[model samples]
Target chain A: MKEKEQMKNKTGYIMLLIVLGLYGILYFVHAGKTLQALEATFGVFKTVAPILLVVFFLMAFLNTFIDEKSVAKHLGDDSGFKGWFIALFGGVLSHGPGYIWYPMLQELRKKGALDGLIVAFLYARSIKLPWLPLMISYFGLTFTVVLTFYVLVGAFVQGIFAGKIMNEAKKDR
Target chain B: MPRNVQRLKETSLQTFKTLQSIAPMLFAVMGLVGIFETFVTPEMIHKIFNAHAIHDMLLATTAGAVSVGQPFLSYIIGGELLDEGISMYAVTAFILSFVTLGIIQIPLEFSIFGARFTIVRNLLSFLFAIVIAYMTTLSTSFLSGYFS
Candidate 1:
C-alpha cells in the first residue's frame, strides 16, 4: 500500500514537471503567447476551482453519509436500468475536469459500481445543464434538444459497450 | 459533538488528499489547453470547415475529436459554422466531437482510467458522435419538413 501511494505521487510529480517544462518552453519561445496562455489558464482555473470544491464536498458527503453498500446497491453491476437512469443525473450534476471525479469513481469502484453507469455519466457530461441556454442560443432550441437527447442515448450506448468489453477482458484474464 | 467534529476532519482530509493526488496533472492539463487556445483561434476553426465535399463529415468529426474547448464555446462555434455554410453533418459532428473527445487530455484520462477503458471509451465516443450528429441533423430537418 505504501509503495502504491508513493508510485501515484511520483506519477503526479512527473506530470506536473512536464507542464512546467512546457510553460518554460512557451515563455522562452513565444513570450507573448505564453502570457496569454497563462492568462487563459487562469481563466480556466477560475471556472474550475469552484467546481472542484463542490466535487470534493460531494465526495466527502458521500463518504460521511453514504456507505459503500448503498452505492453498490444503486449503481452496482446489477443496478439495472434504474441505476443507469439515476447515474445520468448524478454525473451531470457533478462537474469539473474528469480527473476531479476519478477519486470518487475509484471509491465507487471499490464498492462495486457498474462501469457502464460510470461511462454513461462521463459521456453525458458533455451537455451540462447550466450550459444549455448558451447551446440553445447558438444551435437553436430544436437542435440543442435533439443533440442533448442523442448525447444521453450515446452515453448509454457507450456504457453498455464499456461494460461488455471490460467484462470480456476480465474473463480473458 | 466530538465525534461529529472528528468525522468532519476525516472527510476534509480525504477530500484534500484526493485533490493533492490529481492536482499536478490537472494543472498540467489546463496549462496545455491554455497554450492550445493561444494558437487555435476560433477564426482558424471557422476557415477550416467549408470543405462540404463527400468526406466532409469525417473531416469535421475528426477535427472536432481533436480540438478541445469548453462546451459553450463549441456551441457558439457550431453556430458560426452554420453561418459559414458548413453542412449540418460537419457542424454537429464537430460539436459532438469537441465535447466528447479530448486528444490533448488523453494522457490524463489514460492515467485515471487505465489504457483499455480509456481507449475503448474514447473510440466508441468518436464513432457515436458521428452517428448522433447525423441522426440529429436528419431528425431536426426531417421533422421540420414533415411538419411544414
Candidate 2:
C-alpha cells in the first residue's frame, strides 16, 4: 500500500511536469507578446479579485447562517409568484463569471432550489451592467431591449426543460 | 419556548456540519489555483487559440477549459481581439465558453456534483456554446445587412 501511494504521487508529479514543460516552450517563443497580455490580465485581476473574494466569504457565511430548509420553503417551486420573482432577482443579483458560481449553484440545487431559478440566474447575467449606455451606443436600444427580454424568457424556458431532462436522468440513475 | 430553542439548536448544528464538510475541498482548490496562476504565461494561451475562424473557436473552447477568469475579462479580451480583426464568431465562442464551461474547475465540480454529472454538464454546455455562437454571428450579420 505504501509503495502504491508513492507511485501515485510520482505519476501526479510527472503529469504536472509535462503540462508545465509545454507551457514553457510556448512561453519562450512568444515571451514579449505574452508579457503584454499578462500585464493587462493582472491589471483587471487586481480590481475583480478582491471584490469576488469578499462575496465568496459572505455567501459561505450565509450558507452557515440560513437553514437550507427555510430557504427552500420560501424559494422552492411551490412558492408560486413570489418564488419566481426570487428566482429572477437572485439571478440578476448574482455576480461574477457564471462558471465560478457552479460549485455554489450545485450546493443550492442540493438545497432544493428549482431549476427555473437557476436558469433565471444564468440568463440574468446577459442583462448588461447598469452602465447600459455603452451597450445602447453600440447595439442600439431595440436590439438591447429585445435581447434582454429574450434572455429573461429563454432562461425560464430552459430551466423548465432542464428540470424535466435532469429529472429523467435522475430516474435512470 | 424551550422546545423551540432546542429545535433551533439542532438546525444550527446541522448547518455547521454541512459547512464543515465542504470547506476543506473549497479552500484546497482555491489554494492550488493561487499557486498555479503564478507560473502561467500569456504566450502559452495565445498560441493555443491563435488560428483561423473555425479552428480558433475550437481553440477558444479548449483554451477555456484550463483557463480561469471573470467574464468581464473575457469581454475585454474579446474587444481587443475584435479590434485586431479576429472573427466575431471566434470571439463569441470564446466569450460564451469562457463563462459557461470551465476546465480548471472540473475537480471542484466533480467533488460537488459527482464526476458523471459534471462531465455531462460541461460537455453539453461546450457543444451548446458552439451552436449559440455560430447562431449569434449569423444573426448579427443578417441583421446588419437588413438594418444597414
Candidate 3:
C-alpha cells in the first residue's frame, strides 16, 4: 500500500516536472508566450487560493469527524430510505480523492450494501460540499443550486437502474 | 490536551498533508491551464463546441469523461472554459462528467465492482451528465429571468 502511494506521488511529481520542463524549453524558444503562460498560471492560482484554503480546511474537518466505519454501517441492504439519505448526503460530504473511497466502498459492498446505494454514493460525490463555494463563485448560486439538485436526482435514478440491472444479472446467473 | 483541541490538531495536520499531496498536480494543472489560456484561442474552442446546445453537450461530455481530476480543479477548468466563451451546457456537462465519470478509473472500478456494475454505472453517468447539464442551465436562466 505504501509502495502504491509512493508510486502515485511519483507520477504526480513527474507530471509536474514535465509541465515545468515544457515551460523551461518554451522560455528559450518563445520567451514572451512562456511569460504569458506563467502569468496566466499565477492568475489562476491567485483566484483559487482562498477558496482552495477553505476547501482544504473543510476536507480536514470532514476527515477528522467522519470515519469509514460509520459510513459503512448506514449503507447496509435493509437500510431503506435512511440508507438512501445517508448515501446521498454522505457522498456530498465525502472528502479526499475519490479513489481512496473505492476500497472502502468495495468493502461495504462485500458486507451487503446494495449496489444501487453504492452507485448513488459514487454519483452524489460529484456534488462536493468543500467545493460548493468555489463552484458558486464561478457559476453563481442559481446554477450551482440547480445543478446540485439535478445531480442528486440523477444519483438516485442511476442507483435504481444499476441495482435493478445487477439483480437481474444475478438471477440470470 | 482537551478533546476539541486534539481534534483541531488532527484536522490541521490532515489539511496540511492533503494540501501537500495535491500541490504538485494542482500546479501542473495551473500551468497547463496557463498554456491553454495563452495559446488556445476562442476560435479553436468554438470549432470543437460550436455553441449549439446538443453538439456542445455531447462534445463536453466526451471530453469530460476522458479527463480525470478533483472536483475543485474542474471548477477552475470549467470557469476558464466559460471565460473562453464556451456555452454553459458544455461547461456544465464537462464539470459533471469530469468528477462522476472516470474513464481512467475503469480498471480500478472493475476490479472492485463487477464488470456489469461498472459499465452500467459509467454509461448511465455519461448520459445523465448531459441531461443534468441541460436542466441546470435552463433552470438557472429561467430563475434568473424570473428574479429579474
Candidate 4:
C-alpha cells in the first residue's frame, strides 16, 4: 500500500517532466512562440488557481462541518432519477476547466453519490446556458436545438455506460 | 479555546493536504494546455480540417480530441469551419470531439481516477462523439432536403 501511494504521487512530477521536455524542443523550433507558450501557461495557472482554492476551501468546510450522512442521504446509491436530475443540474451550473471538477466528483462519490449521476454531471457541463444563446446565434436555431438535445441525451447515455463499466472494473480489482 | 483551536488546526491541515495533492496535477495540465493553445492556433485549426473526404471525419475527430477549450468556443470555431467550406461531417466531428474527448488531460484524469476507469470512459465518449456527429450530419441534410 505504501509503495502504491508513493508511485501514485510520482506520476504528476513525471508528467510535468515530459511536458517540459516537449516545451524544450518547441523552444528550439519557435523561440518567440515558446515564450508566448510560457506566458499562456502562467495565464492558465492564474485562471485555475482561485477556483481551485474555492473548491479546496469548500472541501475543508464540508469535511469539518457537514457529515457525509446528509449528502449521501439524497445522492446515495438509491438516488435513482432524482439523483440524476441533481447531478445534471449541478453540472450545467458548473463552469471552468473540467479537470477541476474531477477531484470534486471524487469527493461526492465518497459521500455515497451514485457513479452514474457523477458521470452524467460531467457530461452535462457541455450545455452552459450563458453560451446557449451564442451557440444559437452562430449555429442557428434548428442546429443548436438538435445539438443541445443530443448533448443532453448523450450525457445520460455516457453516465450509464461509465457507471456500469467503472463498477465492474472495480469488482474485478 | 484549546479544543476549538485543535479542531481548527486539523481542518487547516486537511485543506493543505488537499492542496498538495492537487497542485502538481494542476500545474502539469496547465503547462501542456498552454503549449497546445500557442502552437495550435486558429489558422492551424483551419488547416487541420482541410481534407473533404468522408473518412476525413476521423482526422477532424483526432484534432478535436487533442484540442481542449470552452464548449461555446467550439461552436464559434465550428461556425468558422463551416464558413471555410469544410464538410458538415468533419465540422460535426470536430465540435463533438472538442467537448467530449481530452487526450491532453488524460494524465491528470488518470491521476485522480484509476487507469481502467479513465480509459474506458474516454473511449466510450470518443465513440459516442463520432456517432452523435454522424447522426447530426445525416439528420441535418435530411431536414434541408425535406424543407427545400
True contacts kept of each: 0.69, 0.03, 0.78, 0.59
Worst lDDT window (10 residues) for model 4 chain B? B47-56
Poorest 10 consecutive residues of model 3 chain A by lDDT?
A95-104
DockQ, model 2, C-alpha based = 0.13
Better TM-score candidate (3, 4):
4
Query: lDDT (CA) for every model shown?
Result: 0.80, 0.58, 0.77, 0.78
lDDT of 2: 0.58
How good is the docking of model 1, by CAPRI class?
Answer: medium
Better of 3 and 4 by lDDT: 4
Instruction: Point to the candidate with the largest DockQ.
Output: 1
Cα misplacement distance, residue A33 of candidate 1 (Å) = 1.3
Residues B1-148 of candidate 1: C-alpha lDDT, one tens digit per residue = 7887788789889878867877777888888888877867888777666566437677777777667667777778778878878888888888888877888777777666778878888888888888998999999998778877
Segments in model 1 whose C-alpha atoms lie over 4 Å from true places: B1-5
Q: What lDDT, from 0 to 1, does candidate 3 have? A: 0.77
Judged by lDDT against the true structure, how good is candidate 1? 0.80
Candidates in order: C-alpha RMSD to true structure: 2.1, 6.8, 7.3, 2.7
- Judging by DockQ, tell me the better candidate of 1 and 2: 1
Per-residue CA lDDT of model 2 for A1-173, tens digit only, reads 45643543454445446544544564687776545544544554565466556545545544655567866876676767777677767666666545446545655777787655665565555554653465455435554454455446655655566566667777897
The residue pairs found clashing in candidate 2 are A91-A121, B65-B103
DockQ, all models: 0.66, 0.13, 0.44, 0.58
Question: Model 4 Cα displacement at B123 (Å)?
Answer: 0.9
Q: Model 3: which residue pairs collide?
A: none
Per-model TM-score (chain A alone) = 0.90, 0.77, 0.58, 0.88
